[model samples]
Target chain A: MNPEQLNSPNDFQTIVNKIYQNEQFDFVGIALQSSEAPHSIKWDFVAGNTNERFRKIVLRSGIGIAGLVVRTGKPFWDNNLNHYEFSDEMYTPIAKTESLRSAVAIPIISPLTNLVRGVLLAGYRSNKIKISGQTALTLSQYL
Target chain B: MLETTRWINNYFNDSTDAIMIFKDDELILSNQIAKDLQNELELNPQYLVEVADSSVKQKFSPTDNCFSCIIQNKMKEISIPITLAKNMPHPLNYFMIYNVIDQNEKVFSLTLKNRGTIDRMDQLAQQRKLTQYVNRAHEKERKRISEDLHDSIAQGVYSAIMGVRRLENNHFTAEEIKELTTVIESQLNDTLTEVKEMALDIRPSVLDNFGLLAALKVLAKRLEENSGVTINVAGNANTEHLSDDIQSVLYRITQESINNALKHANADEITVLLVAHNHYITLEIMDDGDGFDVPKYQHFNGKSMGLMNMNERVKTFNGAFKMESKSGEGTTITVKFPVA
Candidate 1:
């Protein structure tokens, strides 16, 4: 997983596409820290067609979607993301990138101290789609 | 001409007050009261009617009535003092009308005057009560901080210092030296444990850094160590995500209850149950400690600050707090605070 080898925009997309191709999810993406990737945190990895709007977002700790998981060191799951209020302004980059409607994020913690380092965001454009606990665990196993 | 006569007649007939109507400088109608009031002022009924008629015909403004009217805003329903020529028979009480306004602005202020007196008294009383409450809150915070420092960091330092002294003073037989080293190591371990427990108790960095569940585990450990009591805590709350105030109040109440049980109850076991139901958080603390007669204790205590403090904290958030205890029976304290 040297990102340099996957320098093309579709490189990260290839990983998410492989997962969704075998699974039932609508979209899957990897949100790495800007400090780690140095280019784009929004479309760092995309498995679907996303707009230029995805690359416009920069998140601070404890703020937007991925930032909350990173800062709190907790995984967030919303089976019904539509029921949850979305401050879309904070997630405009993500929203535009995948045209996402419902979403969930899990923080990948360090193996030793269990500190949060990055996030894996999975979402769908359909209102009826939900990310269940089983699905989240399954996604975590892969991502 | 015919329409003017009808209008004048209608004006006098429709009003209860003394009415006079005119149009195009002609006196068309005058009510009996108007004629009488006019005559009492040594004004010929006909002549006074003519003057009033002409004033209305000219569309005289409110300023024109200033001489006879007390209230300036004509639009206001008010009591206006008019010179009635000493011959008018109606009482002065009839002069006022309720709910009147002067072109939407109140010309006559009907407010209760001298409200300043009562308001000042109320403000003083409020200030005094607020000051008293603030003082009590400050005192509680100070006590919590002091107890935390004494029980945690201070005790830790004392243990560590003793350990270091034993290590430095190395003039003893090999057997005695072996014992001394063991004592030093024990002291060091105890100090470290104390530091961590005290830090957790004073402010469970877990509650702040983590959440209520982590903090509760810390509190349970502290209570067990200090009281020689076993506290069984159960239930899973996504407490890390709960609001700060709820977490604080629950923690404080739990801490206080455990303290009371340890100090007053000769109980060997305590249990804390937390359940989330119906968008509310309920906490139950039960102890198999010696219970006192509820009524007798209430009368004897006469508002213990500890109990009062808990009640006050609970009430501030519009929560419910209850204590159930009977002599020869164990005690149970329950608190429920809404989250959603």
Candidate 2:
């Protein structure tokens, strides 16, 4: 499915597949917030995942990669993850399960209200991947 | 106040130190501690602004503030001295202030922490942590001793009692009765030996009567016989010039090390060297067994707390302790103390 065809939750997987096929990423995922009180975020669509454990990851705002992007409405990524503590509870819920050493996440904002509604993540399994602002800008173009 | 930020106000208001919040030069909220300071210094709300040093003022301003970016800067800051209208009970009035000013939210807070109060709080926190570690180590020891009594000593004695009762109720030949009596006698003897070993564990009387060398040698011989391992103890720590406390500490450290080697290391041979020169004593224990990661177990580990407990004991007696270990290699512990 193309970006213009993202009318249903099932279509989100095609967008993830589109990004994964067009990029040099090992994994591509989309996480969206629920429209309710105590709005939590979950991985709605993913491509090239090693396992289905990402479906079990539910994060609050300002927590993991997706949650942080939704909370701060800023692009987030770790260029060098050599010293990143995998056992830290803050990021381990997704990073450990997916074995992701580095990732870049960008917010998807609703143009009308200027509020972040979802996040798009492109990541690699190797720690040596150096994701920069140019890389985040490249990923944001897909959103 | 915005409903979203009401919780921050409530949280800061419950602090034990002086905290005052400002919104566009208007005093919005003040905690009880801040009210007390205002009364004692005869100060107005403006004091929070003027009391801050120029060095701190350069940090950030409330309007168009980006202070949150640098909020976690290093501490070790100089105290802000205050000249007050009224005299305080302290010899000098000084504060170490922590400020959080948010221009976007249009609310800023300044918390004036008394230098003396901060020092007292740091000392109390350290004492609390130390008390908890010591209590945990103490409780672990008590559990081990209880397990020994219940599993080995109590069970042995119970079985011997049952054997004696069976001998009374059975109709047997005189020869069989003699053999049974002998068996019961040996069982009681073994229980007696276990009781003696436990008493020795508590505090060996040899340590008081014959001094450190005799105590360590006797301990080594008994452990060698029980564990079927060779333990070599060669030390001339001549206990004459030492006080009773120093002697006991040395004995306890050595005992604990050997026990660790036998139980955890699975070592076949161990060596202990204790030497006392003119003004200092050095003790070293080495074992040929599997060693573990030192830094990993140096923290609050219940099963392997012997290292930290021994280190604490040595430090209490004004001694230096050093430990070296490597996986598949062996463990070595050295302790040194200055003598008078």
Candidate 3:
């Protein structure tokens, strides 16, 4: 809730872990854009991740789902990502590397700037997901 | 023999060389191609004087033994490629450099050669050019369809919404009906926005009315506003010489490169510079991000399609596409196209 609350990596990891445990998601992750490089958002804390590929993933604003969330400051959800028409740059590398099918991304507002400095995403590896905008609204309240 | 001569004439000055003489900035004498090219000459390769300031550099000269250095201390000559006319190969020019003769005298001659004479490969190049022609036709259709959506459908939707709004002004309308009308109005507004965005994606209209320079500046500004990324576009060039297809191709290449920088490279900033000389137009795109291995990622799955499309478009126009990237460093793409 405060700036100091998320100062430590352990604190961020615990938050991601708590959300992953509280919510029924196949995978959950928190991607942060550092002030040093505000354009790049890197997934720092992830729970229930299949591999370490998410760690290596770097996303720019308006590119991937997390990046889009950070850029737009709005939740993005898609049941059939492959069917949707997206920009050519909308690759969603995390979803591909993690084998995630359905995903929901929510903006994480910084207490300091009152602006979106990070993105929290919950994804499902299953082919079908009953998730909707309503689910994203509920998930967003968790933060 | 006639066909051969015509084919040769299509690319060269009677299959020989177009020669010209330049004393400082003044044109003394020139052949047909050189005369045609003289009109478009802006920057007169002033660097030739700088290089001449040192010593003359030559590519390879057989006439070196014939000419004596008795006239001007040393017979100075520099052979370089210069484009005399559009849609023609850059002729390797032989310029006889000299000192700035008193206010009236420094005289230098420029000899232009046909660079290449590959008649056998003409048909193959034409076949590739045909493929590019087909691709361009598809994009033109897209532009037409985009215009239809913007002008016709979007306008129709607007009038229909206006009709609905006017109908709601009547006192006979019930509360439920009014709410339904409001819903319909909002739905129509959403459709209008979506249609406008789709039309923009199909083909930006600014690219048509304004030239590539203005269009690129607008695109960079819009993208930078959408995302917090720093995108700077800088350069000045006369886009009139470029054909519609080549201009579109160049714009697409720049757009795709910027997108790639944001998506793949995690770039924070991107800079694009476009410069055109008499012979060719050059576009340089640079991004500051954590770069990756270029060779390894060149063929990486679905993502490679974007790279392939960009490459194919450049090749379609006979442009040179060069990409340099290092892991953790950054990526830079430099593209050069012959005026032809």
Give me the runs in candidate 3 sitting further than 4 Å from their true place: A1-143, B1-199, B221-228, B277-279, B296-305, B315-318, B338-340
Sorted on lDDT, highest at the top, how do the candidates line up? 2, 3, 1
Model 2: residues with Cα > 4 Å off, grouped in runs? A1-143, B1-98, B102-126, B129-182, B301-304
iRMS for model 2?
31.5
For candidate 3, give the docking quality class from DockQ.
Answer: incorrect
Report the CAPRI category for model 1: incorrect
In terms of lDDT, the poorest run of 10 residues in model 3 chain B is B92-101
Candidate 1 wrong stretches, greater than 4 Å: A1-143, B1-178, B293-303
Measured with C-alpha atoms, the lDDT of residue B36 in candidate 2 is 84
Clashing pairs in 2: none
Q: Better model by lDDT, 1 or 2?
A: 2
Per-residue alpha-carbon lDDT of candidate 1 for residues B1-340, written as tens digits (9 for 90 to 100) = 9999999777655555655444333334557665565465554534433433343343345446454443333643333322333455742222322221242332211111123444677778865765776787679768866865675456546755764676577565675555444444443444455467547656777888877877887788655633335777886777765778888999989888887876677566789988888688899999987887665543213234567668778888888988899877889999998877
Worst 10 residues of 1 chain B by lDDT: B106-115
Calculate DockQ per candidate and list them: 0.01, 0.01, 0.05
Top candidate (TM-score): 2
Give the clashing pairs for model 3: B87-B340
Instruction: Return the lDDT, model 3, position A45.
Output: 89
Predicted model with the maximum lDDT = 2
Q: What DockQ does model 2 achieve?
A: 0.01
